[model samples]
Target: MTEQDPQIVYVVDDDAAMRDSIAELVDSVGMRAETYPSAQAFLDVCKPRHPCCLVLDVRMPGMSGLTLLERLQTQGAPIPVILLTSHGDVPMAVDSMKGGAFDFVQKPYREQALLDCIQAALSLDRDRQNQRETGHRLDQCVSTLTSRERDVFDQMLAGSTSKEIARALDISPRTAEVHRRNVLRKFKVHSTKALIALFAPAPAATQRAS
Candidate 1:
């Protein structure tokens, strides 16, 4: 990660001791940590520019961890959350997973186990960040296309031959070929197949093992 936006692990728990311990563990691994006493505090100031994950206690006083997770989901926040739960909160933790939490760790958890979950969450965030950046760049490239060029680009993606595109658009084959080349050049790809691959959505991330 770049210094301008370093990796971060955010800990949100009402228990001050638990918050401090998690912060220390995150720092020990050379990543930055930010601790909050409640979900509201975290929501008030959290604006993460880097790849990051949240470690949230399931039963905070004001706004519970699960509530916060649902709020984030509604806002389309992309940060992965790992819920911290007690033994009795297992059902809620499982529900959180179905609600799109990255993972959950039971209280009295082993240090290495939590660390493993943090690392996995961070990795997923990084992949998401990269995908967003790539999509933005592709959007810029698409914006540079002329209306005719965009039509040609769409046809190419739809597996239309240059001659077929010309007939569809009522343009000469030579003009259609020129537009095709321009589309390929703008996308920095040499062939239509490569262009299609470039525009393909990334595979969904694998679920974490239980």
Candidate 2:
């Protein structure tokens, strides 16, 4: 899907009334909704690129909701899941959470409560997708660096001054400074701190270097 496409709320419930009601609730908030009569219907069209989450019913005719969640876990990127079940199904809901369900709601839930949960799930999915995209971009940027440039980049991340880097790399201080500038330009960061922030969750050694 295009980057500008609306995030989808996928509703999977064998009960037609429940599916339509959930679809209506999702649509009220301006998000797109795709309803399925069973878990298999959802599995058939769940694409990796879709920014969506599952509003799954705990009990269904053939493949149950938990089964669907387990199957999806092995397929590709994990989709946020919110289980809908009756009050008596509380134990199953707890079990579903351990299996990676985002949240669960009891039957007779307020429309607003369900809507809020769905919105939260959609936001979580969006953030996850954004992080993946950012990581891909970072890899692409790293790929453009030459071996010498890469070495200089690592040294800079290690917090070496130009003079020190020159000694370490057997290059002149002037050359080290040039490489530093190139590294900054390539990373699109104005300063070392900004670079470090962009490369957050850096190694302990890298943090010490910074």
What TM-score fits each model? 0.93, 0.89
The sequence of per-residue lDDT tens digits that candidate 1 reaches over residues 1-210 is 343578899999999999999999999989999999999999999886669999999998989999999999999998889999999998889877888998999998889999999999998998888888899999999999999999999999899999999999999999999999999999999999999999887999864865
Instruction: Tell me model 1's lDDT, rounded to 2 decimals.
Output: 0.91
* Number of the top lDDT candidate: 1
Candidate 2 lDDT over 114-198, as tens digits, reads 8888777877777677777778888887898888889888887777888988999999999988988888898898886776677
Model number with the top TM-score = 1
- Model 2, 38: alpha-carbon shift in Å? 0.5
